[model samples]
Structure formats: structure tokens, C-alpha cells
Target: MDKLLSNIKIEVPPGIYLKDPESSSLGKKIVENSIILLENIGFEDFNFKKLGQLIGSNESSIYRYFESKHKLLIYLTSWYWSWIEYQLVLETYSINDTKDKLIKAIEIVSRTTKQDSKYSHINEVLLNQIVINENSKSYLTKDVDIENKDGSFMPYKRVVQRISEIISAYNTSYKYPLTLASSVIESALHQQFVKIHFKSITNCNDEITPTEFFIDLTLKTLTDGK
Candidate 1:
């Protein structure tokens, strides 16, 4: 697991970004600093102009890597999915029992993320915050069809499919594996939003962790037992 995470260099879809942000010194700075920018200011206020100033580079240099802030957001989100998927596979791939695999898969998505130094260019903490608060904006937009057609969402979808396959292995007779998989994925993200914004309604706290909530719900939903 340590070896695999240490070797991470996730490849984003070609159409997702203008250039690979991990390719050069300037590009790496763009990826590293942009996460900071997005974290400090909300996505609505984030743009290449501000990012360029922050990185001590010009707008054209930043634009050379990303066409727009939307694309940049998509790229960042996709990179995150790819990285987490790597961790997911590393942690769960070797398990022979389907139930164990399914449980481990749920754990990967439900826990709060800690930044891995293997990918120094990306700050996992800020990326997770963006995912909870801003990532839906990338796909919830009107241009979703165009981006989907371009395969920009493939990394995230791949994560869903892997988990869905685990469900099918757990219970071939059960239906709605893919739907359940997507639900767990989206719900895990939204639960963070709920915990932060709707604390009065949520029971998530130090006693009942986000991970415990999802593991209980997912196992019961998958096996029809608590």
C-alpha cells in the first residue's frame, strides 16, 4: 500500500485539461497553488487571473494548462478520484471475501481524508473540501452532457463501477448494485455537507463517526441485516 501510494501519478483524461499539470515545474506549481486558491476563496471567485498572480505566473501560462476554471475544477476532481481509487484498490483489491471487500470499499469513501505526501502537488484536505462544497458544480452545470461525452467523468464513474462489482459479488441475487454504489458515493460526499451545514439534523460527531454511519447503513442495505 505504501509503495503504490508512493508511486502515484494519476492520469487525467486528455480532454479534461489543456495540458498535464504534473508534467513540468510550472505546471506542478499550478496544480499545487490552485488547490490553495480554491481553499481560500470559493469557487465562484476563483479564476486563472488570481491563480496566476498567486503562483507568480501569467494568465496565458496557466491557461496553457487549463482552458477555464470549470475545466480546472473538473481536472482537480478527476485527479482526486483517480488517486483515491488507487488507494481503494490497494486496500481492498486483495480481499477474497466479497463482504469484506464491500466493507473496505465503503470505508475508503466515508472517512475524512488525510493528505498523502506521495502527491505533493495536490493537497488532499483542500481537495476533499472542494469536493464536498464545490465539485457538484462541475457536473450539475448545463454542459454536463458535453463533458460526459468527452469522457471527463470517467475516473469518478470507474470508482462507482468497482464498488458496484463488489456488491454483485456479495449478492448476485440482489438487484440495484450500481444504483446503490452511486448512492453510497454521492451520499458520502453530501454527508460532509450535512455535517458542516446542517449539524442540527445530523447525528455525526466524535461518538458516531461518518465512517460508522455509512458502514452500518451500507452493510444493512447490502445484506439486509444490521
Candidate 2:
């Protein structure tokens, strides 16, 4: 179990980068600054030359780590999901109650992540902002099919699968465990996106995060027929 493992390593698909960003100090710096820049200017306005200036590295150096801006975005978002997966396990590991596990899973996925101080190399908090605002851009492209086949989305799918298993513990016969899991995860993102950008339409209370609402709705769907 990932929860029980120590010093866990997350694998970004080999296709996502020309070189592993964690391997060298410079490569790691590129990743650390990439998050800050992507969250600051947004991906549409982000480029290697700009990143090169930010990190005092040449554009060619950035290219050596990532083939294109698109791949970099994918790498960042994939890393975000992997981080989320770890948190999900850490948060829910002690809960034996199925409903409690389900609720915690939803919150961990939906709520903004706190920056993990031990991981100074990556800013979990800022990365969550990028995931909220720009994650779709990583996959909504012409190469999505190619990337998808190459396991670009496996980290994300693994997260969803973990939560889906928690749901199954409550209702093993539930035909739509994965479906329900995917819906809950996406709903968290969309609700927060809408609440932030188009608040007039969302009636959510400011005191309560979307995670609470999602958990209530998910519980209704899972327990309504019982």
C-alpha cells in the first residue's frame, strides 16, 4: 500500500519528459520555478524562454528536461495527481469506517492542499492552484489520444480508482463505483472553479468549502436506496 510505504517515489510516465526533473539540481529548479510561473501567468502565456529567464537557465536547458510546453504542463498536473494520491492515502489510512473514508477522500481531492514543508522542492499549495485553473489544458489537445495511450493520465486514474474502491466497500454491488468516483472528483473541481469565477450562480456558503457539499451529495447517491 502506498500509505504504508516510506519515501515513496512517484513515477511520471517516461513520455512526459526528455529527462527526469528530479535527477539534477538544475532540473529540480526548473520544476520548482515552473509551478510558480504557471500559477502566476497561466499556461497560455507561459513559455520556455520566460522560464529560462526566471530560473537563470537557458531555453535549451529547459528543453533538455521537457520536450514542449504541453508536456511540461502534463508533467506538472501528473505530479499534482500523484501528490493528491499520497495525501488521500495518508488522510484516509486510519479510518475504518467506509463512510468516513469516503468523506475524507472527497475532501482531500476537492479542497486546496496545504503546502508540505518537507517537500520544499515542490510547492503543493501553488500546484493545486494550477491544477484548479489549468489542469484541463494539459489533456484537452490534439495529442491527447497519443498521450493517453502512453499513460499520461495514469496517476489521475489511480487516484480515482482508490476512491472508487472506498465507495465499493460501502456498496459492493454498486454498478457505478468508478462512475460515481469520477463524477465526485470532477464535481469538486468544477464547483470550485465556478464558485471562484462565476459566484453569482453558486449558492454555496462561504464558510463551507465545496468538499462538504460534495460529500453530502455523494452520500445521498450512495445511501439513498439503502
Candidate 3:
């Protein structure tokens, strides 16, 4: 997640940088420029100073908008999820049934995943943090009051819940609950990518894209051996 977001430039100069309560145009520019930089230099070599310099802004000015690198990382992760939600909403316009919705949803996610090169680093970082780092798992899954006092869940949990809702709409005859299927989907989505990251020796030259395989397999499973 951090790596994917590392492409975004949050702080810019007084004249060129984004101000607090960022205007949409300025914010979009910051994200676009940041992605260009990240693609060239990678995240480890990128930072506010480098970004600020590239965008004709001062480091201090950048800090004013994002505060710290940590805040910037959180913002990026949330932005990815928000974007997914928005795309799903848009795709729903063409989907009238659960089966179609599930298939469309998978296709949309797969397309977005492939096109967003920024997410490569983000996916790599998230997999490492969630599966390898004990402390990060706790933070990622820490309970929060999303709807009611008694109904609390973590950030990832909510994401999973949304995924489950989409899954549930598929073939009602299938006995397995959408929640369980969602967990399977999430595990497959995140962990498999990380595994591929290593198995390909970090070159990312795999032939069969996860999107294709996942979409086909998930549809079959959800459709009761279809």
C-alpha cells in the first residue's frame, strides 16, 4: 500500500502545491505527477523533498498539506478503496442480476488492478505488512464502529463485507455463505499476488494474469459448478 501511494506527491510549493482542503484539480495533478516520478525512481528513492523539487515546490509547503509520510500513506490506501467503490457503483448500472453483477464486478476489479501500476508496489507492501508483520495485522484489523456501537469492525473487514455483498448476489443455490466466499476471494487476491511477486523472482513477468484466472474460477465456483 505504501509503495503504491509512494507515487503520489502530496506537498508542493506555495504557488504550485496543493493547499489544505485540496481542490480536486490540484489534488489530481499531485497524484499524476507523483505516479510519474514513482514509475521512474521507485518508492524507496522517493520522498517529499524529491517530490517537492520536481513539482517546483518547497519541502515545507508539502509538509503543510500531508503533515507526515505516514499520513500520506494512509490517505493513499483509503483512496484506492474509495476508487474501487466508485467504479463498482458505476458498473452496477449495467448489471441487473446477482450473477451478472458478480461477473461484472470481478471484471471491473481485474481491469482496474491491471491498469493501475501504482498498485503493484502497494500490493507488495500490503501483503508483506499483513502476513509478515505481527503488529501490522493488528492495526489493519483493529475494531472500529462503522455502523453501530455493537457492530464494530476493522477497515479491512468493511472491505471484505462489501466484497461479500457482491459475492452473495451470485447464484443463490450455492450453499456456501457469501461471507466465507469473500474471505476466500480476499485471501486469493492478496496472497496469490505476493506469492507471484516472489516466484517470478520479482520481475513480474508471469503469463497468466491473476485477473483472468480469478474471474473465471470465481464465477464457476459461485455458479454451482458452472
Give per-residue CA lDDT, model 3, range 1-226, as digits (tens).
Answer: 5565555532222322225324554444454455556545655576878877887877876676666543343344434445455556666767778777776666554442534444332342342232222212223433323222332113334545555777766654556555554545454445445555566432223565555666677876766633
Order candidates by lDDT, high to low.
2, 1, 3
- For model 3 the local lDDT of residue 198 reads 66
User: Which residue runs does candidate 1 get wrong by more than 4 Å?
Assistant: 1-5
Global Cα lDDT for candidate 3? 0.50
Over 102-125, each residue of candidate 1 has an lDDT whose tens digit, in order, gives: 889988988889988888778999
| Local error of candidate 2 at residue 171 (angstroms) | 1.7
> Per-model C-alpha lDDT, please?
0.87, 0.87, 0.50
lDDT, candidate 1, equals: 0.87
Q: Model 2: per-residue lDDT, tens digit, 1-226? A: 5344636776677779999998999989999999999999999899999999999989999999999998999999999888889888888989999988988898898886788765678998889888889888998889899899999999999999999999999777778989999888877888878888988877665887898888888888888745
Better of 2 and 3 by TM-score: 2
